[model samples]
Target: MATPRPFSRFEFLIAWRYLRARRAEGGVSVMTWISLIGIALGVMALIATLAVRAGFRAEFVDTILGANAHTTVYMAPQRIENEFTDDVYVVPGRFSDYEEIAARLAEVPGVTRTAAVVKGQVMASANDASNVAEVFGISRADLEAMPRIVDPATSYGELDRFDEGIAIGAGIARELGVGVGDRIRLIAPEGARTAFGVTPRVNAYEVTYVFSAGRYDIDRTRIYMPLAEAQSYFNREGVVDEIEVFVTDPERVDEWSFPLLAVAGEGAQVWNWRDASGSFLAALDMEDDVMFVILSVLVLIASMNITSGLIMLVKNKGRDIGILRTMGLTEGSVLRVFFLCGAFTGIIGTLAGVFLGVLLALNVENIMAALNALTGGGAWQPEVRGIYRLPAELRAYDILRAVGLSLALSFIVTIFPARRAARMNPVEALRYE
Candidate 1:
């Protein structure tokens, strides 16, 4: 008996012939073009949406991590001069046990660096300017851990001026019309004075440095001082508000936090940056989920066009399909042929969209610049919400997700038309023609 021919080049040729014949016979109809365009647009939307969300999430997280330590151990409220405390609320005080706490926390697997932090809200004034600012007290030795607050290269002048001095955010400096070598007054909250009729007290300091942390909140409202000076100013000598720890792996923050809290005892509370910015983080996640759903719907709409295009192909190729089946083509091969045709449309459209998406992502900054220039630079202002330029961060996972979803939807759309072709009776199809 003759050996059955291997389903190799010959099978591919049959598939190719079927594909080409379908195309030649009204396959590039209005419906086909619409399907191609829909798929392209869907892919583009998915890429752009995902890129923007990814960029926003990454940048926002970096900003939070950079501005604050990975974990903070603060004096528990009840322990803050003996007041009732809540799990999330820490009473502000000078933590005398900071060194011990730091040593213990440092022993934790992921701890990298630990430092004392003294934080308090203060009203700052220089000349006729005044603004509410958060004062961060940091040790000179531990300054390296707070790189976001001070860039060594641009901030040497500021760092050198730190003796009994303070670094104000650049925005605060601009608002106050003061820079290095300027003086500013600071007012802190003192205990209620029953004897003095609840009077308030204020302190003064010199603004010896100015730095920009690139975040509006930090640059506009944060100030830093030498740890000792801050302690003295707040009248809490040899004490600190909390111990801030930097971890090698940010993902393990909670893993280290619980143990640190246990070691810190009830006197202190351990907090990660996630707690500090929980609302902002939740909003970011919600926005990303919403955008993904919206973009996926766009892709689904695009797949509908694929369905229409395939149905048109099936109708146009009725006679050819009948002839092929009469020539001994199996129903499975008929299905495979149409499926290949639909898949080709999806592949080409997806590739084109990917090319365009990647191009746009790479040049997004430039494109924003051009638009800003065209709009007289108003669009580049930070006064508006979010950052100045449109940020696009394309990740392999996001690309894979978009491609997989698009292709899967395309395949689903091909099924009905493919089955229709497969189920056609050769005699009936030929008799109709």
Candidate 2:
């Protein structure tokens, strides 16, 4: 006597035969194709969306951490009493002890480097064109410490003779049609005190270096001069406006803030990059979540097609199922066969989608290049978002999420139609045939 077992070879053979059956023979070949295509498209969309989102996030963060400081220390608000008048007065705080403060802050466990910086707003002119620029008076040593600006591949010109001249951004060079060794004039509104009146001070300097920060705004407006020159031009002779600090890990910037404040002493304020870019980061996260939900719905809709297709398959094969039941085939065996049909479509569609999505994500830059070549101009502009292009980066977590969600939906939807086919009475199924 032979004992029956579940998911036997006979069950799979029946399922394979029904899957290959022609429409004229009451097969669900057409529905299977439709369901497979829908799921493939849905999964492809999810993978592509996630890859692009991760790319955007990484680019933004890199530009922030590489080109700018992780945290900045500024003079805190101060209030003083007027002894002569017995009236309270507010005096602007200046960091005369900036060097001492910088030394103490550098000792903080996570701190990597610190630089005293003087900033001033002035009108920059060259080639008879003028634009507003934010001038930073930084020492040559500090300027070279910046990874993005000092890199030879990304930046143009030499910083060795930085003290004698100025370093301007690549965007500024393009705006004013100036280049290395080109003459650019900076006009300060508050000039030397004269007996008659105050006049704007106009000074000329040769552009010794030009750098790209990979950010449109930073590259457009930043000009670096020697600390001494900036102090003289801005009439801030001895003190720096603030001290910019870099750290080992920018993500833990908040944790370092308290330690920084302790060393910075009284009348000092510390602000991290997050404080400056919080709103934009929050909006990006919200947009990512919304897109995921919308695309997941698309995937869910695609998986539902599996249910519809399997139901039609069960109805069409009713007579065959009735005959098999009379031939001593159990209901469980019938259910397994129908389940296999739906599972085949889901599994194959998912695998195809993964392959297609990965291809698109990895070759996104190549695709953009092809588009630009065809158009004889850039197909995508970086002006709006301030980066090179829309890059895609695939993460293992995201890929796994897509695969798990798709398979789960596919298996859950396949069960109902499969169970219905198994529960049908042989008499009723044969009567309909």
Candidate 3:
């Protein structure tokens, strides 16, 4: 008698029938279903986690880069070696000629825009309400160039008249119960020197523009004033605190840092956005890595179900195995048949999981809305998270990683049961029958 090819049509036929067999016929139909569902759920969960993590990173970086300068060149004190004594000495500094410095920096390659900014903290009060806010004094042309502040959907009022007064965040508008054309008093603790020491500077300005930056902290605690007005309010005439640099590619600002400093000249310091937010970005990256490890373990645990199911399947088909062995079925054929059973479960489950996970990622926002309605609100808080909605981005590499992990786990766990079935003794298997 001749042996058929390995994993021949007959072996698959036998495996298929066994999978479909009734429980009364000593089949492991229930275990098969259980294993399939487990792997599918595990894969789905892993994919979902990756999608949300990627989305979160994208959103966070966008928020940081959107509202901030790629880099900032500051007028700071620098140590210079004294020629006679060989001693290092420090001197006070300020960008009195900020326009010239900004122009110099703008001449560098990839530098898109430059603006001199005055920054301070002050108290804002209107309509019986008061709050502390961080103020940035910038020119109207530069403010108009800010995509987030000049957005039509979330901002209103006049950009043309921005030089005349102030542009306040929407959150400030709500807190003070004020609107466009309302007057708000700003009080600075460090004010002009007088005969009786120093007095706080108090001045009121009309709200010329109302803007919503879509970030909780910025919208709540930020104010924008015209550059000259800010300079006067801050008591810093003919000078700015720092010059903000906007680059074509913010992510690659490190490449331009040296050149920026070179053009900025002596006693100047260049600080990029990444340097300012490095700790925050590092924390996010670490969390994402941890989540991937945790979710991958979940997929591994779910794959363990395949081992138990296949073992039960091997035990149940002992009598059939004995008869097949006696009729000249080889050990390799038996192994292939049983291995194919688990492989089928793995492939199908992985496909199903990919489908469900992609679907979940695509509809996550809608689902979040539905959950919020069902729970009567409080599902997500933009104030706490600094984001208005949950974002999910399904990446192809992430999906492939999940599928590869699930299938690899399935194939590995199926080996022992398949081997056991292949090595079974025909005489012992038939003895109880």
Best by TM-score: 2
Give the alpha carbon lDDT tens digit for every residue of 1-433 in model 1. 4433444454556555654544456654667667777888888878877887787677767766776888888776553233454335444545787778778878877788888878878888878889999988898677655676667544434576676688888888888888777788887776235665644457767777777655667778998888887877766677888889889888557788677877777766778887877787799889888888888888888888877777777787789889988888788778777777778778877877787777777777788789888999876675454343467899998888888888888888888888998999999889968
Against the true structure, candidate 3 reaches a TM-score of 0.91
Model 3 agreement with the true structure over 282-358: per-residue lDDT tens digits: 99889888988898888788778888888988888899899999988899999999998888888888999998999
Off by over 4 Å in 2: 1-6, 23-27, 79-92, 195-198, 372-379
> If scored against the real structure, what TM-score would every candidate get?
0.86, 0.93, 0.91
Model 2, C-alpha of 343: deviation from truth (Å): 1.8
Candidate 2 per-residue lDDT, tens place, 1-433, comes to 4647988888888888887858585447877888889888888989988998988888888888877889999987578888998998775566888889988888889899999999888899999899899999899999999987887987888799899899998889999999999999999998777897878899999999999988888889999999999989888888999999999999889999888888887778888899999889899899989998898899889989889888888888889989999888888888888988888888888988888889889988898889978987468666778776678989998888888888888888899999999998999989856
Ranking of candidates on TM-score, top first: 2, 3, 1
Q: Which segments of candidate 1 are over 4 A away from where they belong?
A: 1-27, 79-93, 152-156, 189-204, 373-390
* RMSD for each of the candidates: 4.3, 2.3, 3.4
Candidate 1 lDDT at 1 equals 44
